[model samples]
Target chain A: MIVTVTPNPSVDEIYWVDRLKIGKETQEEYLTRATDSDISAGGKGINISIFLARMGLENIAMGFVGGYTGHVVVRALRDEGVTTNFVWMGSGETRINLTVLEHGREHIPILIDGPGIAVAEGEMNRFMRRYRRMLKVADWVVLAGSLPPQVNLAFYYELAKLAKQAGVKVAISAGASCLTHCLPAAPNIVKPDTREHLSFEWMKLGTKEEIISAGKRIVQDGVEIMIVSHEVTGDIVITRDSIWEINARVQTTQFRNLVGADDALLGGVIYQIYNGAGIEQALRFGLAAGIVSAESREKVCRDMGKIEREMANVTLNRI
Target chain B: MKVGEIMTRDVTSVEKDIPVKELIFILDSAKMSNMPVVDEEGKLIAFISEKDIIKAALPGYFEMLHSTSFIPDMNQFAKKLGQIADDPVERHMHSDVICVEVDDDDLQAADLIIRKNLKSLPVIDAERRLVGVVKRIDLLHHLL
Candidate 1:
């Protein structure tokens, strides 16, 4: 079983509008055509769950959720048949990420910082107990995305350690502090997107050699697989033994949505790894999911068959 | 004719490890006597009902009392169950639930519900992951 942890998930409100041009009406209102609006659950871990399920893999999404919107997010995942184990907060509500995408235009995303998490000492203890229990059932455990303000980023480090101790493979998709702390814990897989890698002071990933060196540094820290994806240059998968560059077969579609494609990439890799595929094949599958996700309006992947067909274009070269 | 065509897609369910106390709100608000307990894949691991909650909660009293007596207000009994709110429903839920596949005939689902005296039946896939639910009322609304 693949178990995922999302600390700060959200309910997203996506509005499809004609244009982004502001009118004199407060300059703050982005009017939606009522029928052009959709709401879905967001967060890296939840996206992983959706992508895995679409690929016919079983996954569980767990983390902290609260308030009315939390219920909505939970129900949405359940409706998608992704099992959830979110711990409810007593007071604060989950955040809502409002996105405005005009036809044939770039999306403007305004993210509201959701409820401030002040997990009581007792609550932390209880949540940890439950988290450990979940790790036991996992063949692979995924720690993904940003954490709530009140949470210590070291929590991921502890979780990775626990999963390793339990003999479960660990994959991490977080950035900055969480990644920094967990790197020494040496998860089996570390998938960090462009922005996340750019956050590092030493990571000047402009050249191909620089990016490969950066990935090697991470692998040397004990991570078995380090995957860094760039929208323009494609994906690089680095391991202790070898480095593989996988090409993305991105097709031009009038309708496009770019968000969460990287998460889908990680999802594909995990799905392949769960099925015991080799590193080269896994990277190709990962790129296939990313390419298909760009063609979908929803952040999650929609077409598994299309992804499979596109896999042929995902050429891999051992560098 | 298939269960997928008529089964309610928005089915309410609970996780196996959830506290039985949590069911009070879901069961009471939804007016549901029972709900399926699902695992990570949305597979039907078990089913929990009001009777299961009460049975799991009243174990202490059952062992203490030997003689039969008149019952008090139902609310009082519920109040007593609240004391063991931390107890997991996994201890009480029916693990071996009779479920219908989504592609199964609606007649087969209705007949199973009747034969087994079930309130509703879980609609699953070939993998046994829950897909929907077919309540008795759904059958009534369709046939009658």
Candidate 2:
């Protein structure tokens, strides 16, 4: 069974206000009445696991959850019929991130960083030991998204190495720090967005060609698959065996929030891989998942049947 | 008729520091779907409906004296109330209060009752103080 590990899982609360006023207090000059709020459990891997569960995939989601917020996240998962095997940390609640949007159209979002959790080193070791034990039972161990400050970026690389040694295929979906550290070690697959691609160049020493060259060079560095998602450009590149260029399908109508698109992509990739689809097919699945997210008002893309139907309409080219 | 003429001044509210358990008691006693959570200055801050309180307390909560006969933690429930209540009412309260000014037509309040899908709308003064609440039942009385 596929195993998804989310290091920093959160209860994502998305809400809408007719007019969101920030910094200054807004008084009702006698007008608007109420706002709408919808909440869900979200984190990259948790999201991926939810989508996988929706598709009737057999997998267990493992992660860190503590305090009251953890309880909410678990309840949310159970409500969706997804199985979770989370380790409860001693101190602090699981983080709650609020994605606040004003009305239906405004693109601006107010994201709360949430409260931090405090864990002792011993507690960390205990969690790691439990994770290792769980990993031993997993068929494909997928490490997705950022970890809480309790663990280092190296911890992810080390965990991937451990999984690799145990013959568990390791897939990492991360940005900046963890991506930089893990690239050299080379996990089975690394998915980076275009924003991440440009950020590394701006932050570190590199040009556009240099970064593409570096991404290309990593094929020799032991990474089996490199998926570069250019979201704004609506295309994804699968650099393995040969370069495969896949474009996102155009939306039939107006789209909603862009949140959880990447996680859906990852879910599509994992689903394809688990079903024994080749790399090219898996890449197309990932692209379709990302594109389908725009079709729904909620942005979580709950309908896999719709996604598959939409994917058929999307064309894939081998470059 | 004026908004104040039709509004109910006998309104019930909870303090900023009242525990969630006590709020549950108030909710149970008031038989209210929603409460106008107010501050010491009597300004409407936030509101906690039965639904909001239940969603917060039910998930992952344990009762210490579930089997005991003694007055179970009213505060156990109140602790949740306190958690929600401890914050400033302004922080969580619906600041966009659908209010009718002092001299507005009573018909406007009736429209608000139907359009906003609110059981009641707090009628306020120029300073935004809670003057009275016009319930749907009261508006129905006017219609009758």
Scored by lDDT, the top model is 1
User: What is the C-alpha lDDT profile of model 1 across B8-115, one tens digit per residue?
Assistant: 654357777778777665566445689888775556788888877777656456657765363454655666687768778787789888889999999999999999
User: What lDDT is reached at residue A36 by model 1?
Assistant: 76
**DockQ (model 2, Cα):** 0.01
Q: Residue by residue across A1-319, what tens digits does model 1's lDDT show?
A: 8888888888877776665555574557564462277788888888888889788786778877776787788878766767666666655777877766666653233334354456556446546765776675679998988888778878899999999999999999977556877887899998764554464556666577877898899899899998877544278788999988888655444335556777888999999989999888788888888777766777877787887887987888898
Candidate 2 segments exceeding 4 Å error: A23-35, A102-110, A193-198, A201-211, A251-253, B1-144
Candidate 1 regions with alpha-carbon error over 4 angstroms: A22-35, A107-126, A193-197, A201-210, A249-255, B1-144
What is the lDDT, from 0 to 100, of the residue B62 in candidate 1?
A: 63
> How far out, in Å, is residue B11 in model 1?
14
Clashing pairs in 2: B19-B82, B20-B77, B20-B78, B20-B81, B20-B82, B21-B77, B21-B78, B45-B93, B46-B93
Best candidate (score: TM-score): 1
Candidate 2 per-residue C-alpha lDDT over A1-319 given as tens digits, one digit per residue, 9 for 90 to 100: 6778888888887776677665546655444333777678888788888888777775667777777788787667655656555666666788887776665553335667574465568546545664665565567877887678757778778888888877888788877667767775678888764434344433541343444565667677888877766543255444656655677557433345556777887788888988999876777777677767754546467787788776776677765
